[model samples]
Target: MLFGAKNSSNPRLQLLKDVVLFKDLSMRELAMVDSLMHERRYLADEIIFDEGEEGQGLFVVLSGRVKIARFASPLEMLIELGPGAFFGEVALLDQSVRSAQARALEDVQIAVLFRAEFYSLLETHSAIASRISFQLARVLAARLRQAVANTDRHHEAA
Candidate 1:
């Protein structure tokens, strides 16, 4: 008999369960959302996406670290994220240019939730979509608040 032949642990499903965007979802609902995800991998120092490119979807880091940077005069490094963290989320709400470039700091695995698929979920599985949207809103709001706090701190130091 083959081990993990009939009952296997799915790594992707396991990763999705811990993601903040799907934290409120039950296992069955996460399985539904998992069905819509696309997976991609990147090597160390690879450009996952570039600044100013049209955003397509949100990417959740499955394994390894990713750096988010703004290619401006000073070349600011926005954030570095690891497993369970999601980025490019604004794309899910609108057709917009990516504000930062994401590059792999190490070998990375990511799961993508495209805008179109998320929209389809909103229409077909409204409850699941609503929960995700709520979580997304909370994440955005917290980021905005943190930005404001950081700006204030910078102003005070200068």
Candidate 2:
């Protein structure tokens, strides 16, 4: 519900620099991306986004913790994200239903990067966008590898 963090005195770019998605960006580039983002705050236990919802963008944690979970009958937790971490990254690339839900584990603040804004960046600043995209691909590939490894371990245990 919040828009850009320009009104706040806090250094948004400082937080942005630590985020993996923008790690390769310069201070100027990070400022450009920061201007495109809207800051949102969540209370403890609030759902940031729900499972099966149409993904629209990715959220980067600025402060506090978040839990990524598959809210099934058994409630399987996927991961816990903290400051400088990002989640819902796949949404930035395509329109798809989220496979997991993201919820605030504590009072949290985050910056959201919408897909439309990102696409515009791709058109106007391909260099910066491509850097982010490359990082995204690496993150996804690493997750895939970890998932496969977990599956193999489960199979061997069974």
lDDT of 2 by residue, 1-158 (tens): 27434524549788889998899999888888888888999999999999999999989999999999997889999899999999999999999999999999999999999999999999999999999999999999998999999999999999
TM of each candidate vs. truth = 0.91, 0.92
**Model 1, range 1-158, lDDT digits (tens) per residue?**
45322113456878888899999999888888887888899999999999999999999999999999998889899899999999999999999999999999999999999999999999999999999999999999999999999999999999
What lDDT would each prediction earn against the true structure?
0.92, 0.92
Q: Quick one: best TM-score, which candidate? A: 2
* Position 14, candidate 1: lDDT: 82
What is the Cα-based lDDT of residue 23 in candidate 2?
91
Residue ranges of candidate 1 with Cα displaced over 4 Å:
1-9
Query: What TM-score does candidate 2 get on C-alpha atoms?
Result: 0.92
Q: State model 1's lDDT.
A: 0.92
